[model samples]
Target: MTTTAVDPAKCRRCHRALTSAKSIATGYGPGCAAKIRGAAKTADLTDFKPAQIAKATELIEQGGILRTRRPNLYTAVSGDGNTTYLVARQACTCPAGIKNRACYHRAALTILAAA
Candidate 1:
């Protein structure tokens, strides 16, 4: 049996009532998740190109699948192939994603190719 964080409150840093927690990342109430998710969206403007974004997205998916049995299957990174990270429902494997407001693989493939 696997147990990944589900309720938002279990997350490390969320201030509102949480409804859903998918992956090791915590989700906030509509107010917070929207804001954070938005920040994650804006993060793509930094430097990565569309191709890199797609690769990153694919890493997350592969990591997600690798983590499918997590909270029980032994935590592992769900994004990026370089580093294998410890993941929970409220946290991610990469420092960039954890340190500050960063984009989830959710926006990975969506980054503008022109950017």
Candidate 2:
């Protein structure tokens, strides 16, 4: 019988090769995983509206938020999935955020970080 080649594990966020068993099992490198835990600890959701938080949770469940190469930066998909906006801790490129209003993209980021 021929042997099948096994693929090596990689980080989920950065796609970097994982050498440690813990990293492989977690599907994220130590650094990338730390970003989520660290951000979650410092996140403040008090200012966001309940509706916004609910929508953010929905967005995340639908896999609408994606982590970028840079830490604390992510791409958030629009409601219709036609466009993507850059989201950071303090800002987002969405229409509401462009006008300095609260946007669900940022809320999604917080929710994702906590997860």
- TM-score of each predicted structure versus truth: 0.32, 0.63
Q: Give the TM-score of candidate 1.
A: 0.32
Runs of candidate 2 exceeding 4 Å displacement: 1-43
Clash count, one per candidate = 4, 0
Q: How many backbone overlaps does candidate 1 show?
A: 4
Clashing pairs in 2: none
Q: Which candidate comes out best when scored by TM-score?
A: 2
lDDT, candidates in the order shown: 0.42, 0.78
Error of 2 at 36 (Å): 10
Residue 50 CA error for candidate 2 (Å)?
Answer: 0.9
Q: What is the model-wide C-alpha lDDT for candidate 1?
A: 0.42
In model 1, where do residues sit more than 4 Å from their true spots?
1-8, 19-26, 51-76, 79-83, 86-115
Q: Each model's RMSD to truth, in Å?
A: 11.2, 5.7
lDDT of 2 by residue, 34-64 (tens): 7755644456777788788778766755557
lDDT of 1 by residue, 2-114 (tens): 98976535322244554455523532244543544454456544555565455544543343323344342224444444455543333445565477434343234232111
